[model samples]
Target: MTKGRPGENPAERPRAAVMEDVAELAGVSAMTVSRVLNAPEKVRPETRARVLAAVRELDYRPNSAARVLVTGRSGVLGVVCFDTTLYGPASTLFGIEQAARDSDYLVSIASLPALNRRWITRGIDRLRSQSVDGVIVVAPHESAAEGLRNLPPGLPVVDVGGGADLPVPVAAVDQFAGAARATRHLLSLGHRTVWHLSGPPNWIDASGRVAGWRSVLEAEGREIPEPLVGDWTAHSGYEIGKRLAREPGVTAIFVANDHMAMGVLRALRETGRRVPEDVSVVGFDDVPEAAYFWPPLTTVRQNFGEVGRQAFQLLLDRIAGMEGEARRMVEPELVVRESTGVSP
Candidate 1:
């Protein structure tokens, strides 16, 4: 009887591949494979290419559990945010997760029940217990930003959408610049002065926008109408818009966000005010539906994706013990649509 070579039976399951198998297949030492996987920049380009080819050929995946045991790093990141229900925060979370995935790291989120010192501390503790390599905080409210300033030292941390001059690194859209641009656009169109509809008073974004809008009006020596504060919602915008519609001198208005702008549009229409013809409107945050708004909303386009990417990169740098630029502010663009026009 011919003996089939020891364990070559077709019915036998192929063994799971390991780093040793990959190293052998690539004609390299196990240490070389390790360097290639962990720090590819330190490995010769030709050597890395060969090891990668072997890994693909065997469909090898790194043993993350074993890696943690050996290196004391879980290869995970922590994210702390107040609410993901809102568009800005939700989008920022998505961006961070996407960035983490691209870098072969896992994300563990701790959504806070409230934006305060106690909750922030609890969130960081939860993540620390999981052995996260670093953390990214996505809290835009002043209370949360203030809490971040005194976080217990040791863990690498970065802040997203937080205020300027933070103790940790920060990544955010230049809210001031965006609002200023919107105000300038209205002024350029021959509007005597642009009124403002701002977001909640507690948010850093709202304050930045207010400062920007006021700065422009002051520099241009234009009449600065007192800004109407809203809760960053359509209803608030509608309520405020109704009041503005009744004012005869209100020719141009800059709103903090798109949802409020939609409400303002409705309020104007119901009050017999034709948009642009009677009241030109401009809003921030070019939400997906902004362009579809009746007459299309002229708004500021914030690159949340870029903000997320920068936040992730900052965390990575912090983890590596690098002291790079502490704050990276992304520039926002102005999108012109049919909702705005020359003062009429």
Candidate 2:
């Protein structure tokens, strides 16, 4: 066996690199190292460079627990969302993660099976246990509003696609405006009145869209046709579309989402009705696949990325003990396409 160096234990494991090691290596105080890691703007360029170089050389990772103890922040944000299989929620979550990454913050996500008060609270608790600086809840269902009202005190919370009366700050795409635009677009094409294929009633987004669509029809003194509710799935849209396809009065249809709109298109095609000819269609959520639907869909584009960024910013503000706007809404755009045209 090789002999060990004097007083050196060769069998002992090496000590892990720490912030103090980086500070010593960079010829700076531990405070300077902390500043460089947490608030680099406060450190001089030369000092920051030296600290960064030392950090790389030592492969030093700031101890999150120790940093949280010292600074009261973990640099980790939490996201509580539901069933990411759907496009809207999934895209919103993706946007939040992207924004967090750009800001050099880590994201810890808690995806729940349901949007009820029980599930939402549990999700928040799980994130809180992980020492997240703040949390953004992406539950857009009516059931979640009640849960939001009952959250534990003092933690910064932001809601995405939630109701306006929420106790916490809110950042969401203007679903009402988007739905209204879709309804108005169909009406602009000279359709007598637009019919609506809405999402489930329990969803806040669905209710907002319904209200917007209904508002337009009522304001214009047009016939207010009852909306058919779907489960925000293409299958639901297809089933509902089949019923609408048989009705001659259904000249224009405003769907709550693109997936359902695609279903409607299929139903119309199978029923021998040419889109934008015998019947026009408009949908919300300009999902990527919307443009490829046989007759490309004319839909409302929700700026989910902007909403996510705004939500993250709002959380940051709250975490910093700043009081600002309670709500921020990203405007949705109307994208006209082949699916909608003048009434024949």
Q: Of the candidates shown, which would achieve the greatest lDDT relative to the real structure?
A: 1
Identify the runs in model 1 with alpha carbons over 4 angstroms from their true place.
1-63
Question: Could you give me the TM-score of model 2 versus the true structure?
Answer: 0.91
lDDT of 1 by residue, 174-287 (tens): 999999999999999999999999999889999999999999999999988999999999999999999999999999999999999999999999999999899999999999
Could you tell me which 10 consecutive residues in candidate 1 have the lowest summed lDDT? 1-10
Q: Residue 307 in model 2: shift from native, Å? A: 0.7
lDDT of 2 by residue, 1-344 (tens): 53443236758555668888899999999999989987999999999999999999989988878878877888899999998877877888888889999988999999997778999999999999988999999989997888887878778899999987888899998898988899898898899999999999999999999999999999999999999999999999999999999999889999999999999999999999999899999989899988999899999999888888899989989998987558998999999999998987
lDDT accuracy of residue 89 in candidate 2 = 77
Best by TM-score: 2
Residue 268 displacement in candidate 2 (angstroms): 0.8
In angstroms, give how far residue 17 of model 1 lies from its true place: 9.2
lDDT of 1 at 37: 90
TM-score, every prediction: 0.84, 0.91
List per-candidate RMSD values in Å.
Answer: 5.0, 3.3
